[model samples]
Target: MPVTSAALLLHHGRGADAHVLIAHMGGPFWARKDERAWSIPKGVVEPGEDVEAAARREFAEELGVPAPDLPVRDLGPFRYTSGKVVHVLAVEVPAALVGSPDDPASPDLTTRPGTSTAQVEWPPRSGRRIDVPEVDRAVWFALPRARPLLVLGQQPVLDALVAATTP
Candidate 1:
């Protein structure tokens, strides 16, 4: 059976050029990569857990806060090149929640990078225990701009957003 994941496509506006939230992939393998590396906050669906609940849980685990109490619209699912299906939700969060670079409370900018730890072995087989962040940081970008920044397989997820919300 193919694996399925849940993702959050947070936006702040409607139609084209909508600002979307993204997180940089963490851990060593992705550390030096940039283009086509970032991704939506998402995780695999666990047995018996509601997909939406799993999505919310993943977002909190990665971002260090509960997802804002906003209505979430299902954008449906897509299969990526890796052959995994991902169910995504489109959420429109207020700018205040993800404030500007000049704002003191901005989790994406004005403040320090958000950190979530994962235990891994350094040097692969060396068995040295090391803790690395689950995500290096997060930022918001317009859909077009986010395209080049998003993981290649997830581009369709953004396209779905544009098509669904455009008038």
Candidate 2:
């Protein structure tokens, strides 16, 4: 059986004009890479657990906040080159939770980011544990802008999200 993972895709706006929230993966290996390195807030589904619940838990673990209690829709069991079957739930981040998109300094992103920090031993055995943010940062991007930056494997979720809201 392929490894299964669950993710949450938080989007906002109407129809074709939506923007989705995504995160940059953490750790030294991903530090310098930008294109094709970021990922949705997600994780492996443990035995017998509900996929949506797991997605919510992973969101909280990765971003440090409970996912807003809202209606969620399935995007896909998008299969990746790595053989991970990613099941995703998407919901529009309520307008009440966001600030103006033009203001980069605004703190009202639908979901707050970066509390599930991780620790790693850098230099491959230097014995120094370095703490890093699991999801170093997050951004809300329109599909055009996000397609180029997201991990290729997960792009289908974006397409599905757009399709779901499109007329």
Candidate 3:
């Protein structure tokens, strides 16, 4: 069975985007084009890899940052248009603990070209390269603002995450 795991990436924003939480991603197979790309840190669990363990590993390898100690609430799984089953999980992280993978210590950072640091070759024919952990930046975005930025398949997880954090 083909299965994947990912993170509900988040960051802290004090100014206008404060209450807003954001996720990180590169983009889909076709729509990718700088900033238009979005994603949560995710990857396929290797055989015998535990679910939570896969989530944590994907987060670190994809984001190039250590996984937070936040509690992960299993948000269940969802199917993608590709017919692949993706397991989702949510975690609430303090805004302060969040930072770009390139500058893992820089809180006011954005844009990390090779920060995603993971790669996957794509197109059964072209064999072009695609990066795994496909995000270069991650930031918190307020409600409604995040709608257009999230990957098509992962938005529901974000909604569930918002509900989980609210009230």
Candidate 4:
């Protein structure tokens, strides 16, 4: 199996109720702007790693914020454009916890009990590295408002999250 990891679907207090923090994906492999450009914080999981645990780790790595204590629903699995099957899990973070990953003025993103944060370089060429702080700019959304901002396949994940959370 081509292994992949999980990500947190976050909504900031300032934006729409369903606003998710979508990364600009700074690496050379990703586009600098435009649609089909954003993605929830995600990565691959190593062997023996717990799926949820890996999700928490990847969330912290990509966004700089600690994983929220919100409930998680297994969104099951989906394949990427690369044919890698990813297991999706959704977790909610309150508005207070969502913000700019590059904001040096903000408090440090705290870690969940057993989880830790990691960093990766973007642009793939600058030889300069940047930390994955959960997300670049997290914003709230109202579903319809989120359409153009989210990565192509990611919209479905948000919809699934809303459906799972809805009464």
The residue pairs that clash in candidate 1, if any, are none
For candidate 1, give the lDDT of residue 60.
74
Root-mean-square deviation per candidate: 3.3, 4.0, 5.1, 6.0
- For candidate 2, list the clashing residue pairs, or say none: none
Residue 26's C-alpha lDDT in candidate 1?
A: 71
TM-score of each: 0.85, 0.83, 0.67, 0.66
Error of 4 at 143 (Å): 2.1
**Pairs of residues clashing in candidate 3:** 13-18, 20-141, 20-142, 21-141, 22-140, 24-39, 25-38, 25-39, 26-37
lDDT of 3: 0.57
The better candidate by TM-score, 2 or 3, is 2
- Superposed model 4: Cα runs more than 4 Å off: 12-17, 28-31, 95-136
**What C-alpha lDDT, on a 0 to 100 scale, does residue 149 get in candidate 3?**
69
At residue 159, give the lDDT of candidate 1: 80
For residue 156, give model 2's deviation from the true position in Å: 1.5
Question: Over the stretch 1-167, how does candidate 3's per-residue lDDT look in tens digits?
Answer: 55565544443432333343444554445335534355566778788888778877876655556667667777778677877766877665566554434334322223443344445666646778765545545555564666666667766765666555555
State model 1's lDDT: 0.78
Candidate 4 lands at a TM-score of 0.66
lDDT of 1 by residue, 1-167 (tens): 78999987788777786888888877787788889989898998999888889888888777766676678989998888779988999887677755743321223421344445788888789979887777777788888889998988888888888888887
What's the lDDT for candidate 4?
Answer: 0.58
Candidate topping TM-score: 1
The digit string of per-residue lDDT tens for model 2 on 70-102 reads: 889888799999887999999776655666533
Indicate the residue-level lDDT of 24 in model 1. Answer: 84
